[model samples]
Target: MMKNNISYIDKVRENILDHLKTYQHSETIYNASKYSIEAGGKGLRPLLLFTALEALDTDIEKGISAASAIEMIHTYSLIHDDLPAMDNDDLRRGKPTNHIVFGEAAAILAGDNLLNESFNVIAKDKNLSAEVRIKLVETISNRSGQSGMISGQMLDIEAENRKTSLEELESIHAYKTGALIKAPVLSACIIAQAAPEISERLEKFSEVIGVLFQIKDDILDLEGNPELTGKNTGSDAKKGKVTYISELGLNGAKEALAKKVSEANSILNSLDELISTAGLRKIVQMFAERDQ
Candidate 1:
């Protein structure tokens, strides 16, 4: 199942890249956007989107545009996050960041271009109905906009250099990291036209995994290999940013991760009678045990 999931992820990455190539008429903007989009991070958002569709017994191809759009937004966030005004990181996915390779101005434009183009891609998708497209746009916008990821980012920046309570840290990440993560899964639910009961269960599952993803990331930042993670470990600590590991201690954080993982699996188990949850179960394990 893991190998199959990897195969699906590869297919999704290729589809997104092919879709992105349609905007290659420009020189600098196109190159900068392509560079970051093609960077070597795992296409987790798209994969989750596809996997959710599979779990719902929907054709994964039905979600191609949405998956691409979400990835573009995610890549845009990373590009802006690495800028001097933000995290100021020099490396991303084991290579020079967009700003480092393309200069700050071009990189900023590249991020902007991706953000704008993401909406266009969804709005113009001919495969989905007008109503579905509109819902997709609305969902992505709400999740990635101020009410979701961006608000979380602001909270994170504010909390830096200070001790944050566990509740505060979770709330911050529930937006920063968890929002985008939830976007893909929720997008999948929308695409599948999942029944209300099933959608509610999956939403709950997404929420658990969203927090689980962050907890695992916090653990990785402290103990992961830079070669595999494609960025500096311990950089969070160096930046004096609060994290799950900081608030809960290393073992405490791991315990929280285990609890979330179990919760996620239980949610999936509940859905087993309604849908084939094999793929989602694999995703839970991947989130819990990924090295990077």
Candidate 2:
């Protein structure tokens, strides 16, 4: 990845963390939410939105609240995903999970709080117009709610101890994982008021990247360094969750990841004249090759 693009993504992640802390209130639940947000992650969703907005020649400032909100939503999902009723994980980002420190109920409340606060952040941001804010809320809700992330999650739960066809597996990821990823890309387009054709292309690019994200995660689970990923490996196999690696094997998954990276690059290159693509191209490389 290019140094500039890496620096840009890091800068955005730092700013989101700062925003999360700044908006935190004086309450125990707030502390729980803050703890999860500060636990640290790729912050890739928010970063993608901001970078896409930049590429679209829009004001990055207008996307900040949305970006931060997306990160909060992502963190909230992770918190819930680690609960006893769910993945039953005790670690996240190499730290005690929310439920481990706070009670399970409190952790659930914290996740709920974060999900609500994410909308509050978006709805309250004065920088964006009402039209833009409304669209942002709609996209986030539709994508992260029952129809998107939730759907994928439910499918994942159902897939446990059962064989899933490749198409079914893709459906699970597209919803559970791809929906949120698509939101940021679409949000940028909305805030930018991009043309229909441009928006369509970017949407397709987002979908590819979204699945690639999951594929890479699967590969990482199989071979990634725990020190870097901050999570244990082989949980998918242990849990009998269907993943790209499980279906395609290591070499096959890597090949698919490479193909998606190429597809993403092609999409971005085509849009370079419309938006500077250096940032996104670098991101594609990073995602395809990331060890964590």
TM-score of each: 0.96, 0.93
**What lDDT is obtained when candidate 1 is compared to the true structure?**
0.89
User: What local distance difference test score does each model get?
Assistant: 0.89, 0.86
Tell me the tens digit of each residue's lDDT in model 1 across 70-92: 88899999999999999999989
Lowest summed lDDT window (length 10), candidate 1: 1-10
Best-matching candidate per lDDT? 1
Error of 1 at 10 (Å): 3.5
lDDT by residue (140-232, candidate 2, tens digit) is 899999999998999999999887788998999999999999999999999999999899999999999999999999999999988899998
Residue pairs of candidate 2 with colliding backbone atoms = 152-176
